[model samples]
Target: MVSKELVLKAEIRKENGKKHSARLRLQGKIPAVVYGHKQEPQSIVLDLHDFTEGLHHGHKLFDIEIGSNKEKLLVKEVQYDHLGKKIIHADLIRVDLSEKVEVSVPLVFKGTPAGASEGGILEEHLDSIEIECAVTEIPESIDVSVKGLKIDESLHVRDIALPAGVKLVTDPELLVIACSKPIEVAPVEEAAGAEEPTSPEVITERKPKEGEEEESEKKE
Candidate 1:
């Protein structure tokens, strides 16, 4: 579980469009908007550094303080530049603490697989799963143990143990992880021996013309 308190101080944004957003970035602020449920979209601007630090803390819910007003929101989506290093845009969803929200939770593997010790390969199929739970009850990640997994054995979404009040929204049959035996490759020597080269006697030799042969005899 990840629990942290983050406070973002922002002000209502009056301007819109690309030019206004560029100006806001130049002023060291990030443009953002809040909307969800029955609330109308509210445009605002927050300090770039503060907004980034809040995301770094791993708290899904945000406590946004806009002047004298406080809004509880969930980080719905975050867009970044082509390099994936800078934040370009963000969407915040207002949510009540008691309300259940559907969100994707990351999956984490715990313990080494038994098949690995037996020289079998392990494969992960899914990295995350969607689940619905109360905002406050949101889990940081779901854990699935891979210990004692034999070759051809798999763990599905339904096998994962989730926190109380959490209901999985993904298909139960979705594979999370599996183990398989290593593929065997035959030796090159055997493959080469299986192929036989063509015999020279089977090939037809071209015959020389009679005039060319007479010219060759005169030269001799």
Candidate 2:
């Protein structure tokens, strides 16, 4: 998959303390640092919305323009607030189109597994995998199909098919997904029924009076 291109307009930051970073955030911008590949580290800030929008659309490669200088950068990490409701900071690394770069690519599963019909539960262990490949050959996401997978079977990192230039940085023996028998869950209703309350029943019947019974026998 190819990522949608996103352009971020950034301005070089002159300050580098928490107070200054707070001030930038108050102005609706996020503080960030860009440095890698023997390049000069630059302190910068960009619009919070611009950063969030690019991330939401899965744009890994960022085209950052600082003043008259423009360079292609890659998102390495992002720090979030305690509640994870806000973006606190971001780490950007300089990238060269001709060099191989390592990045984490999300895995997308396609199709239903045959084990699902056989009452087997499917579990996904990893959502993304790290790989090193040329900048131009990097995929937005890796696609893994779960169709025809049987119970007690699992797929590992080695099962993934990668591009010609791409190499898996994660361990090949690491489990990605698996199909197994459903775990046994205790039956709540059965347990509740075992301790059911038992209440006794009462019955009463009325008898005829002696005088009324004698009159009825004489008339008969």
Candidate 3:
């Protein structure tokens, strides 16, 4: 669940583009944007260390306080540097606490499947599922128990039990994961006569052409 007291302090940005963004990075800040329905997109900058620390604190839904106005937002996308070690930019989507919004949360599988204990392989289709819920009701992660799952058994999105004001947004019939036995491929067997070449037909005699027969008899 998102913490009710979680809030992020952000500052409006006056510059954009690569050059200006690089200068922001040197100042220990990162470029960020927030936009949503009926709201004008706002350009801003965040303290890199502070922003990352909030994520480490397990904040899935952020209560962003910009200027005198506070807005609830979800982390939509994150841009990383070439090395993927540094945060270059981020996109935040504003949300309404009273209105339901869709967001993908990580899928957490708990307990060992019965098939897995019996030597069957467990395969997962997706790591997350989309859910529609109020900002306050958003879960940190959805837990799906695979306990007693047998071979050939599967779990779907419809099986999840959502919170009281939350609903599943993904396809109900979508297969989340399955338990199956490992397949053993057999080797191909060659036929006994496969390596040998076939014999050609034996024609007893070749008939001469009519003109050739006449010319041969005349020459003779």
Candidate with the greatest TM-score versus the true structure = 2
Off by over 4 Å in 3: 2-5, 81-86, 183-220
Candidate 3 C-alpha lDDT tens digits along 1-220: 5534368789998877989999999999999999897778999988898888776665667887889988778888888899988888999998776777788788889999999877888899988988888777777777899987899999988987776777888899999899998887899788666666769988888889999999999998
* Candidate 2 displacement at residue 28 in angstroms: 2.3
Q: After superposition, how far is residue 186 of candidate 1 from its true place, in Å?
A: 4.5
- Residues 42-121 of candidate 1: C-alpha lDDT, one tens digit per residue: 99887888788777666778799988989888888887768998786788889888798998888889998888877889
Off by over 4 Å in 1: 22-28, 185-220
- The stretch of ten residues in a row with the least summed lDDT in candidate 3 is 1-10
Give candidate 1's whole-model lDDT: 0.85
What lDDT tens digits, residue by residue, belong to model 2 across residues 1-220?
A: 7675578899999888999988888988999999898988899998999899888788888999999999888999998989998898999999888998989999999888889988998899999999998877778889999997889998999999887788999999999999999888986664444665777777767677999889989999
The C-alpha local distance difference test score for the whole of candidate 3 amounts to 0.84
lDDT of 3 at 122: 86
